[model samples]
Target: MERKMIRISGKRQITIPQKYFDLLGFDTEAECILRGNELVIRPVSERSGGEFAEAILADLISQGYQGDELLSKFKETQKKVRPAVKTMIDEADALAATGGSTASLDDLFGTEER
Candidate 1:
């Protein structure tokens, strides 16, 4: 894709070009990202919480985990992760309530990538 220049106004807002808006559709909101020295804008996609679950189940199924065995393992993982997930959500809520900036998911989940 060819790069297009955009000027940020004194208010620190840059108008997203009409082409991007047209392509992404103005109906949905776009998420702005700051990655190192780069800025990225992407439309928010519909959430399917099952995507990761699907991946894990697919891998396990490939390895012969199925039916009752699959369900049992899933339950076990959920039992293990449920509390941690709640804790993460609580922490996120506390931070957001205080208007704090989180650097990454690593900061949120306490799992930093090297």
Candidate 2:
């Protein structure tokens, strides 16, 4: 690939040439990455989109997981776990409302209680 120079505008933005954009098939929301001394541009098609869902469904079918059973298991796990997390967050909020310092582990764990 031949190196091409792009002039920076007053706002410090450089427009990518149309040839490069066309060659890469980059659409409006394409992502670019800068790694050390190299620049990498990636189109959305090269990324993992709904393909993960397809892969997961294939794996679940291969493992003999029925749709309703899988959903029920997920719901059961969420119901069991959410209450503990909510209680912890509520306790933290109560402590925060007391205007207590939370800057250190000792303060948070009540080690400095007078």
Candidate 3:
């Protein structure tokens, strides 16, 4: 882990080290996350909400969505992906902290050898 003490400006803005910025592919925007007691600042993924675009569109189209309605619903569903993922991560972390086991494939998708 590379560690460097940086001075926060009067406006509370801190500059990212050039090495770290280039290494992490920092762009014009970043995502700030607070996990436990640590604050994490990472590059905003260009693929965020985009990876699921095809799947979301397929499902919506299969439901007979078209025209502006399809576009609107696609945008709406895409917006929910990030929040849903964050919730799952938080739940998983809580479960791990409590030493709780997560569901198996059989529990989630059912067993084929019924």
* Candidate-wise lDDT, in order: 0.71, 0.62, 0.84
- Candidate 3 TM-score, true structure as reference: 0.61
Model 1 spans with C-alpha error above 4 angstroms: 26-28, 48-114
Among the numbered candidates, top TM-score falls to: 3
Model 2, stretches more than 4 Å misplaced?
A: 46-54, 65-114
Q: Write the per-residue lDDT of candidate 1 for residues 1-44, one digit (tens) a residue.
A: 86789999999988888997788775557778889998888876
lDDT of 1: 0.71
What does the lDDT read for residue 103 in candidate 1?
47
Q: Report the lDDT of model 1 for residue 109.
A: 72
Model 2: pairs clashing at backbone N, Cα or C within 3 Å: none
Weakest lDDT window of 10 consecutive positions for candidate 3: 105-114
- Between candidates 2 and 3, the one scoring higher on lDDT is 3
lDDT of 3 by residue, 11-114 (tens): 99999999999999999999998999998999998765888899999999999999999999999999988887676677666666776577664443345531
* Order of the predicted models by TM-score, top scorer first: 3, 2, 1
**Candidates 1 and 2, the one with greater lDDT:** 1
Q: In candidate 2, what are the lDDT values of residues 1-114, reduced to their tens digit?
A: 667899989998777788888997988766677899997767756333333455445555666777798666444444544454446556666778886555454444435322
TM-score list, all predictions: 0.42, 0.43, 0.61
How many clashes in each structure?
Answer: 0, 0, 0
